[model samples]
Target: MPVVPVGRSADNAVTTSPQRQRPTIAIVGAGIAGLAAAWELVAGPDSQGGDGPEVVVLESSDRIGGKLRSTEFAGRNVDLAADAFLAQRPEATGLCDELDLTGELVPVGASGASIWARGRLRPMPEGLSLGVPTRSWWPFYRSGILSTGESLRVATDLVVPHRGTVGVTGDRSVGDIVGERLGRPIVERLVDPLIGGIHAGGVDDLSAAATFPQLIAASRQSGSLLRQLGRARVPAPRSAAPPPLFWSLRGTTASLAVALAGALARRGVAVHTGVSVDAVERAGPAGANGATHPSWTIALGGSGPPPTGAVVMADGTSSLRVDGVVLAAPAREAAVLLGPLAPVAAGLLSAVEYASVALVTLAFDPGAIRSPLHGTGFLVPRISTFDGRPALITGCTYLGRKWPHLARPGDELLRVSVGRFGDSRPAGLDDDELTAAVFAELTRLLDIVGTPVETMVTRWNGAFPQYRVGHLDRVARIEQSVAELGGVAVAGATYRGVGIPACIGSGQTAARLVLESLSAGADPAGRSPGRVDPTR
Candidate 1:
């Protein structure tokens, strides 16, 4: 494999000739998904044309990393959004291995978290799978999140006759399934807070298959969620405990993106930031390589098409012809690009909804809060209300306590999350208002006094995509429709799953789909006989 020179040639056309030209692919949106796709294309075995096809990553934003950004505060590196990834998920950890970042992987400091429930902070129940009590009845009964009666009702699930196959094959809301088996109290008090925190939406509207596939799989295996969990549980050995469930790069999440960007540069992959793709379409019958597949023209912010032997350029906006495209932007962004070419898949992408959230990170005097900030911060139950008003703060992460590397003696860093589905108040509030509201609540919740030494409020609008019931089916339809287009594919938080690992997996999958079509000499304007399944 050899390095490929990047950028447009002297005549403003792609440098390679049709006879020996390598296929070029464009990746839109330089988030984790797009970067991961590029990594797979350049670093994976399938990459052709010396090391790989000429790759170009276009980012709408001035920088990359999207939600995986980190900033320095309180004399330590702090993640503005997600701090870590599930170590059990092979994609994220696997990508780290490929990047030679395994040495920097550090496990989370402390494991368990607490919940503010029933007018008090209570420890979360132990041995629970996503808040479904599994090992014993005592944990749930004592956790105080659920009433004693509710705990007993949940325990009865072990002997309760298996319900009809609602979740056996089809889909159901997480709230519906959990409520039916364990009662409303467990669903509202326990499951809703934990799962809802992840999606920033109500569990009643979240897809059981997409959100809690383990529970669905368990339901099929044992007919009872509780029984299946119990049977699956492996007690910790007395002599040694298990490893941490989550891990992060020691340099912070943003460092991973920085490293990846550096790797792309070294591989001669052209990455252009602050470039918005207005639209994408099939250019003609053949690509720069004179192949049926990979012939696509991207409309830039400027107007008009590129002249023959010259890439379109107007007011710093230029259109580039490519062999294949990976639409790794947000669901809505992707829909806008795909609407003109593949309306069915565009509609499905449009149907995928999103939830916005705000993270208010404050650096407060260590002496201001007297209470022992135990564990990782705490989650606010969806049902929780303050002053007869809904709880404004969704959850809080005690940065210093949760990760020892960020610990400092004089002050503490607290990241408070606000907003969720059906809750538009936080979104409407100004940053100052949001900070004040969150600060007041934090003071009350943590028995803190005085003001913060510093504050930073980061709002992620439409950052989380809501995976409603039948989400998997919807994704399949979207993929099928995209596949029919031959050279175009989509990947992001909108499909399959929304976590870091899931997004990475989707990107890698999308890259393969597009490359396979290109390599097979498939048609770009119509359905291809050699289109590959993204799931495989």
Candidate 2:
């Protein structure tokens, strides 16, 4: 097969035609990563008189958005999944704008949040990002979140020498770093639960450097993490937005997948589902005759279009020989697929651990609980979330108050969080038992009580990745290994962050990498795709 030339022309008009001849890109996953990659390739400029770059996205799942799963429950819609992205998380916000969805964004209202700690419900001390108290003094002396002595210790976070010792694995676990720097009180009570809970990683294994880059930057940049946080600013208020609260599509995060999928379809991407790729072996370049096109023997064993270029794993399964392959699966999953392509990367991918988590959504007659369900719920400190025990409730979002569609007069919507992986799941406990447990805990701490009108429980094993200290080295190693694989790259929460924004950014980054590789006349592996573009 003769090497198909790139620089194909872009009509750039509203019209899209499958004129063929342009470089073909195969995207394996339809998830955000894959979709983003495919969109990037399709949107690239090609001078050829023919069509622009072509993209094919293959997904194994019937639907898309791995782990960002959301399903309908009760007469109301429960996030049964992720509800919002931090306003500060740039990646997700940027993607929304790029997708023209930024206007739809809603910030969690300013009603404020609380933390379930030290046997009670206390307002999240102002100046706290996650559990790291930005304002050490107020919380230290006045807040109920920590004891006076504990607060002083936390406030002394100013003086804790940076003791982030790298482990033999050559990385620092969040456990050692935070413990050394902030001490046990902060780590056990707030840091562990708030920050640690995000990735479901315990302090001992979470990577402070990789997982919480900003936090580390805070400490390094300002000499004190507390000081850096003390300056943290909330996003400006907006009125045109719906409810001005952290928001999600009335459906589920799945709506994001649907929107992207639809957008891809409109953009002329060939989307194939139920396709399973066994293995990806590099095929030789197309001969000068052009009869033998650079292709992938679709391992479907069943049937499908014989594969080709810009292989994007939108759904996370790694496969294809194209301009590039962007992996968008969990780190462990990436580890399994890229093992042969990049061993160290595979090792690092495997090494970057994940924690299991469970989310329980309990519905109640608003009047049932002691206090009116307000603002966002509370976070159970790691001590409470850990202890191999789930807090009576990690936090409850007043769903109705959050999004207008979620709740209304006479009806109420409340989502109760339960277990974090490594913490005991709410299994074995019946609905009544779980509800009672939550109530007991809530009552014990918040001084509220009432019976649930209805309840829902969910458990996610390895919900998010815990980038322990030295995670950067691990990721760098993995990147080098992937580079050697020729046309493959990895992206997603497993590498950078766990928020919807970060993941979306990962997808966009992977897309840009693919674009850059293309313009450089490099194949998926950075070599010429088919013919040596001597010009380069």
By TM-score, who's the top model here?
1
lDDT to native, each model = 0.80, 0.59
Give all TM-scores, in the order shown: 0.91, 0.79
Weakest 10 consecutive residues, lDDT, candidate 1? 1-10
- Candidate 1 runs further than 4 Å off: 1-17, 45-51, 163-168, 220-223, 232-241, 286-290, 302-310, 314-316, 524-536
Identify the leading candidate in terms of lDDT.
1
lDDT of 2 by residue, 1-536 (tens): 22321122222110112233455455666666667666666654452234665566766666676666676666755565677766555655555565677666655544666666676667766556666766446644576677877777776767865443233234456566567666787777777767766776666777766766555555455356566656653545665653442446545545666677777777777666666455544444333124123233222321343233323333433334343456666777677766555567777788765665556565665566666444566666655643455454555666766666666565566666666545564665766677677666655554445656667767666677767667777777777666554445677777777777767777777766654554444334433233332221
Q: Show where candidate 2 strays beyond 4 Å.
A: 1-20, 43-51, 157-171, 218-225, 228-247, 250-253, 285-298, 301-323, 372-374, 385-393, 424-450, 522-536
The true-versus-predicted C-alpha distance at residue 470 of model 2, in Å, is: 1.7
**What's the distance in Å from true for residue 71, model 1?**
1.9
After best superposition, candidate 1 residue 485: deviation in angstroms?
A: 1.0
Q: Write the per-residue lDDT of candidate 1 for residues 87-128, one digit (tens) a residue.
A: 777999898888899999988888788888778778897798
